[model samples]
Target: MCVISGTHGVEGFCGSGAQIALLEDAAVIAAVEKYGVAVMFYHALNPYGFSYCARTNEDNIDLNRNFRDFSRPLPVNAAYREVHDFMVPSTWPPTPENEARIGAYLSTRGEAALQAAVSGGQCDCADGLFYGGAAPAWSNGVFRDMLRRHAASRRRFAWIDFHTGLGPYGHAEKIHSGPNDAAMIARARAWYGIDVTSFHDGSSTSAVLTGVNYEAPLEECPGVECTGIALEYGTLSLLETLQALRGDAWLRNHPDADAKTRAAIKRRCRDAFYCDADDWKAMVYDQARDACLQAITQLAAAPVPH
Candidate 1:
């Protein structure tokens, strides 16, 4: 079993915290060992983003979107092209005229279109939101290597990647990330419970994305039947999360901004991704513990594939 968190950098605080908390818990460890499961913990996949409290990496690549096969044609997002300028303007906070322009676009295009355009992972713009890098990022290479080394021998693999910023506050949404076959879906639902949602089924809070991190394992270890889920915990509302992301991007673009402005942007980024409350942390830990245990139990019963 592999558990990962902090793939989004600034969003890493919640996941990293949960990983640390879970790892330290004797019960969690005992349960995994009892089930004869080997657990690999990956914390802060994007160290730069985690350290700087930004969403993207040193090159401003969204690590979650940087997992595509670069030898082939990159996935295009025409919708993202339509709203790129409006989303990230020349000025921070956006001018009133720009805001009006965005409002007009949203009124015409609708929220779903906006969500798909912004969050669907674009390869055209290197500096824009959810930009899948032109080439494999450092994190991508590291993760691929880790999969080959650690998971290649395993016949069945189960993963739970922790994330934040896209659901009801404090709720954990189990998102299916592997193949959408009925059997696979059934198995995931059985293990994680019926609350699981699949991106293919249009039931997930997330938009259909390209170059997601979870696909890396399948690409690296084709011999293994890899099953993965993104345990997305909610912090703020969608609009608020977008605002915070935009604010952080603006700060990145304008690094010379005053300390107060920078601090405020950082604070917004944190609030957008992390609840910073005891109750919220408790919910995160409980959900993670339950999910991990479920995966361990199911994998233990299944025979290892040859």
Candidate 2:
């Protein structure tokens, strides 16, 4: 079992908590022993973002979107180019005109179109949101190395990557994290259940994103039967979370801004991703535990390990 936390940096608040809980739980420990499952817990895969309370590393690269076979031609997000100016905007708090432009675009092009344009992977905009880096990042190489060392020879691997800031509050939307391969996606559904959604099929709340880090495992652990899903929990409304993200990006670009504005943006950015409530925490941890147990059960039940 491969469990990853902090892929988005700030989302690690919820994910890290869940990981700690799993580590301390006697039930979890018993299951691991019973199944003889090898568990690799990657904590804070993007440490800089986790430590600094930002979503990206020092270079402002979204680690979630930073992994890819960079030798190939990058995927072009032309729609991102169309909306980049307003989405990233020239100023914080976005001018009324900028906000209106988004509304108008959404009204005409629809919200899903706007989401795909804004959140789908893009490499041209260095400082923009969801920018897939032009090349593999340092952490990208480190992750691949970890996979090579730990998972390269595994016969059957199951991964659960924890994420936040999407879906209804406290709901763990199991998003198929692997590619569009029918077999892998089916395995994910079989293990995690049918509710596991896929962006490739437009069943996921997320956009069809590329440069996702899962490619690292597929490449590093070739021929291993793998099933992966991102357990995404909601914290805030999409617009609210998006606004927080814009402010965060703006703050990254403008370090000379006033302390008050900087503090406010930081607060909102954290709030958009992490809910500091007991109820929400319990919900997140319980769901995470349940997901881990489900994966463990499947791992134990596999008829013939390859």
Give the TM-score of each candidate: 0.97, 0.97
lDDT of 2 by residue, 151-236 (tens): 98888888899999989998999999988999888888888889999999999999999888888888899888778899999999
Model 2 / residue 230 / CA error / Å: 0.4
- Tens-place lDDT digits, model 1, residues 1-306: 998877999888888888888878898889888888899998889999999988899998998888877899987899899888878777876799988987898799877788889999998887689888899899989988999999988889999998999998889999997766777777789888898999878999899988888778888888787778999999988878987888887888888999999999999998899998999999999999899888888898876766
Which one wins on TM-score?
A: 2
lDDT of 2 at 51: 86
Best by lDDT: 2
Pairs in steric clash, model 2: none
lDDT of each: 0.87, 0.89
